[model samples]
Target: MASAQDPATAQHPASQNSNGSSDPRKSLDGVVEKEEERKEEELISPDTSDAQPETRAVTGWKWILICAGLYCAIFLYGLDNTIAADIQSAILETYGDVGQLAWIGTGFPLGSVATILPVGKAYGIFNAKWVHLGSVLVFCVGSAVCGATPNMSALIVGRVIAGVGGAGLYLGMLNLIAINTLEKERPAYMGGTGVIWGAGTILGPVIGGAFADSSATWRWAFYINLVIFGVLLPALFYIPSFNPQPGVSPVIKLKELDWIGTALIAGVYTLFVVVLTLGGVEWAWSDGRTIALFVVCGVILLLFMAQQFFAILTTPERRIFPIHFLKSRTMIILYACTACGSTAMFTVIYYIPLLFQFSRGDNGIESAVRLLPFIIVLSFFIMASGQLLGLFGYYMVFYLVGGAFLLIGASLMFTVRAGTNIGAVYGYEVLIAIGAGLIAQIAYSVGPSKVPPQDMAAAIGYMNVAQIGGLLIALAISGAVFQNIAFHDLNRLLSPLGHSAQEIHGAIAGSQSSLFVNLPSDVRDTAIELIVKSISSIYALVIAAGALCFVTGALLKREKLYDSKPVAAA
Candidate 1:
């Protein structure tokens, strides 16, 4: 065995003559020995350190495969949102209640929010390959269950499972590419990923509408996800595995894992979600049970903060949510804007399909098919924005433009009346779709740039949580607002049409398609007109919200794209 030598001693003739301190150059054995040490440590303490990135250059096709996998997963996940809106009429027919139908859409997002943090931490611990594979597998299984679901309860379970896994896949794709790609090259790769994501969205409604129109309906939509998921196998072969640093311990910095803090966060967030889901649907928003749950969530959040403080004092390592993130003006502003965006997206999606089927006089199949325009517009912008960001390095111009588009679209939608032109009304949808596409393009960009690269996953998680949390609040409040306005208007208009308010509401409550199918042609057309007018105000409220978010986002510190050049600490 070669003796150890100080590399410094070898260069000095005097020290060399005295005998090179140990082995003159430790470049070889030190690296080899560390690998040996890690192998031995693997049995005792398992860790998949995401540090010490490899030098292997990813080729063009590998980027394509990864993008393709990410696209399928995003499309598959997002498809549920669109298809469910269209097929709500069919599900209502089977399940027999508006409350029951809402659960299918709500369940998946609940699962996603629940699992997001744990999965983010896991990115540093497990083999990313297995994590990606396992998530996809679970999603496929969930999709299968939802497709063949016999009852409302079973469908909720399936959506929850699929959402949980999908949460993993979405984050995994971003982290995997960030860790793998060189810095300057990352934008183009992300752009490619965006393109694929856009393409997949187009398939959701077209395929879903077609399937639902045929004998397939909602069942075929879920099965199609299974087929898309199966296509991910080819990319798995190329996703890189960690080779590890030669002798570094495989054990990660577990003190970074804050178990108590995690439990507190889970308790607080889960209860909050539970209460919100129940609000306006099962319990009054200000009901005793809701109030108690909200109090419990607050207490839990307080406990979490206390635990973090204790960790800072007691632990031998660094803090988790370091002060930099907390003090960041840019981070806070972005968080707020993203929250508003989520609110706008969730609100419109809930009501627009209702309007289309009831007012536009479309079938469940036709209503879902009509959403293709929004999906098409959204996908086109995502691809274009991603590429533009990669090439020019500044995407805020698009963010502002997109924000303005959404504002205009929402304003137009709000102004609509009983006899609104179908073509003109839908022009609003395309505008918001374009805006949403542009905002999404910049969201993944903004949060990552201002924060430390080491904290990228956590930052991404924060942005998502903020966005979704807003959605939860918006859904409960807005869902109630929508129901009240639509019901009140339908009640007033139905009297003139010689229908009872109860009868009109019964049709509106179920799904858009049912509102038409359940009524006579004259009543159906009349119900359509009234439903459209009432919802116009709702769209206006949402448009105002989106415009505010855009204003705030525009005002946020316009940090340029993150360059690979090492940043020096002030």
Candidate 2:
């Protein structure tokens, strides 16, 4: 373990005296510097230092098939993030509950955030192959439920269930790659996942719109997951199992779970999301129900923190949330960077379509197609960053570059209007896409490299929490922001246009049957201006997120991550 920093130090060798021998003073300084670095590592390192069990890596066609299956599963997870965006009108038409419509988008991330840590822990303790298979099966079942759901409530439940499965699948993919690939090869594989994920996220609305606009119906958006799963079912058998605690009994492993901690944390996040989701849309900010929810969320958060400190439900070694991450400046900065990057990326994915839909009168498919410039550039850069990092070994550069792009791009987007040139809007989005794609998945690769094999799961879990939780929080807040502002401004200006309040509400609610569409040409143009103004205002949040990401990137340690020498995980 003492030699783990050798590769980094070798990358920047200490200076020597003119005689080619190290100067005494410089030697002393080098020793002191090395000592300080060791102290920092110890201060932040996890309590467990046990060596992981060795396993045979899958090979040849088996490896190829397994990788394909894993990539497809991740694509499904990413697709779920924005599939509902283009089909909200269709779902509303069927369910007639506009208030619950947001849940269609929020439910998946909430479930993922609420359970990501526990799922990460489970992967560490259980048989890897079985757990991965179970996760896939769970996701398939959730998709089935969503496809067949009779109402919005059932659909929301299915989204949540799928989210839970998605969390496990996501972590499993990372863990599998960690165990299976060589250090030099890992970044390329991880980057491959990022590429697939970005594609799925960008393409989600396109697929959903096609379904909604066709006789196949919007329900096929979920059923599509099952179709992919069935196609890859055979590959499940090829995923080699590598349990960290192989002989541990099922009963002992069950007892090892931090159930109380899981429940407390879930309650806190669930309440927090609920408050955000319902506060402005369903209830006033001053409503008693909203106030009560905030109070409960605060209390549960305190209990969760206390449980982590006191080890009440599980020992420090088995705690789902890693407490030491709070003390490590590197982990803190990485968490913040991941969060901000995710928030910025997802904000655009969910809202940019609305810009086209409202201002340009583009339908779901057309708006989705319009995003190709952003999507193509983002996907290419995401894959490029991974490959370049694999070769160059400086992860910080991507963050700095990406952050700068996000800040500049988001600032430009903030200035856009309904009548802005279509070409210019496309250019602004590409800038943002570059920033978001670069930083989006970098943490997954870098965070694990900072820790030993035994703590990789926790590190991955910590980053996953940031990645999913950030998007959940962003969506909740941005949705509230967009809804409240749009409703107020539209009602104030359009009520005198000979339109009923319901008609204005219906138009903004994404109802295809809204009578607001039948307004006189000049009045409709005015309404479009108002709609675009509200949506564009959300970029202010993206700008803030991008600025934070840049700050964190500047704070990261300057060092190389890969070398000929092994990383000293044992």
Candidate 3:
């Protein structure tokens, strides 16, 4: 066998002198010399050490196909939301209990908020195409589980799982649009995408109510997603791979994940939701459980803020919260506007069906049909806002107009009473829907349009988190307001009719808003009046939320879109 020195000399033939023979010492010396050269090269060429992957440009029919797939996925997410709203009454009727009704709505948003940051980071590190597909698959599985669940608790758990998947799909879609579209053309593409989301939002109630009304049962509302996913999956396969940080190894990416920050945020929001859902409904607001949860939530939120602040100093690169963005007044205003606007929007979506079912004596299908004006108006405005944005290149004016409409609509809704004019009621709902649609998706573009492409994902993710968080808070607070007012009002009105306190509590807890329907005719009219009053009180909160949205929008600093690159010709 050749000696070690001989092998080194053979590998490095340059070490051989002009002579035909090689020296072992010379070979060893040359090996050291070449290693030193490699070290020098590495030091000088740091960028080549972990070269970034080239961004693959997707244009033409392939891009359109990918956008179409994303639209389907988002449509499924929107359908799930309205489906739950339409089916909650059915679920309450099936279980013959109203205590868990809030959980059904609360769980999905909680899960979504919990996963938003993590999912946003995941897209940056992995192949976005695969990540998006996996999210859709997970969502499909969760939908299946929800359909097959035998009890309310299982259904709530399934909603949470599906929500986790939705968080990923939502971020993935936005990221894809941001990456693929030109800066100047992004608003139009995003708005066009919003049209799909708007259609989903519009059709969700109609389709869900039809499914619930059918022999297929309310469970079919979820089962329908599976069929939709089958069509969407093939389209997803054609999406080009997009990995923003391909140079980063999976292990390094995992290490850099802000686990502590994520855990703190998740814990804080989870506890906050628990307190809101339980307080004044299942338990007294002063109950030990409620108090403890509120206190724990407060403490955890403080810790999360502290951790975010410390992260900026210690490990800014790995921080998920992106505290630097908060320094911009416009970003803060945008977030606040998004949150307040969402609060009003979600409150309307949840409670309007209750108004129809309880006050108007409408079934699920009938209520959805009655809601058509609202859905149609909302969908129209969503598409219209995008076109307006494309032409004007300004958003604050739309926000101001939208907020004014929301405030006017919400104030008008509170005036709805028994025997209120049907025409007037529909008109009010249309106004609110138009206002909501104008502002809802447009707020997402504000941050990304102003920030660099590198910051787009985080900025958009934060906006989503704000929206979902607002929905959760609004749902919790509005539920508490509705339950407490309805319970007390019903108890006062019914107790004089010889119903015991225990009986009043039992009736209200067992039948939900439908309790008014099951009462004797003599008491029914009075109960309906009381129920309408309680729901109207919740509308008062919506008014406040809308006004806050307006104020926040007015305060937002105006900024031109930082990126003005022309779209590539299709």
Give per-residue lDDT, candidate 3, residue 272.
80
Ranking by lDDT: 2, 3, 1
TM-score, structure 2 vs. true: 0.84
TM-score per prediction, in order, is: 0.75, 0.84, 0.83
What lDDT score goes with residue 338 in model 1? 63
Instruction: Kindly provide the TM-score of model 3 when superposed on the true structure, using C-alpha atoms.
Output: 0.83
Candidate 2 lDDT over 1-570, as tens digits, reads 000111111101122333444332132236447657966986898445684753336678888899989888888888988787788777877776666656777888888888888877776567667888899998888888999999988998998899889887776676676556654666567656666777778888888888888888999999999988999979978886665554557888788789999999889878887887788777889999999999989999999999988889688877768887677677788888888888887788777877887777777788778778888888777767666777899888888888899999999998888899999999999999999888877777677677654455567678878988898888877877777777788888888776765566577766255655577778777777887888888888889888888888898778765632213331
lDDT score for candidate 3 against the true structure: 0.72
Per-candidate count of clashing residue pairs (backbone under 3 Å)? 10, 0, 0
Model 2 residue 174 lDDT score: 69
The model with the greater lDDT, 1 or 3, is: 3
Clashes of 3: 0
Q: What is the C-alpha lDDT of each candidate?
A: 0.61, 0.76, 0.72
Worst 10 residues of 3 by lDDT: 1-10
Q: Can you write out model 1's per-residue Cα lDDT over 13-38, one digit (the tens) per residue? A: 11112332323223333544655687
Off-target runs (Cα >4 Å) in candidate 2 are 1-64, 177-188, 241-243, 390-394, 496-502, 558-570
Q: Is candidate 1 or candidate 2 better by lDDT?
A: 2
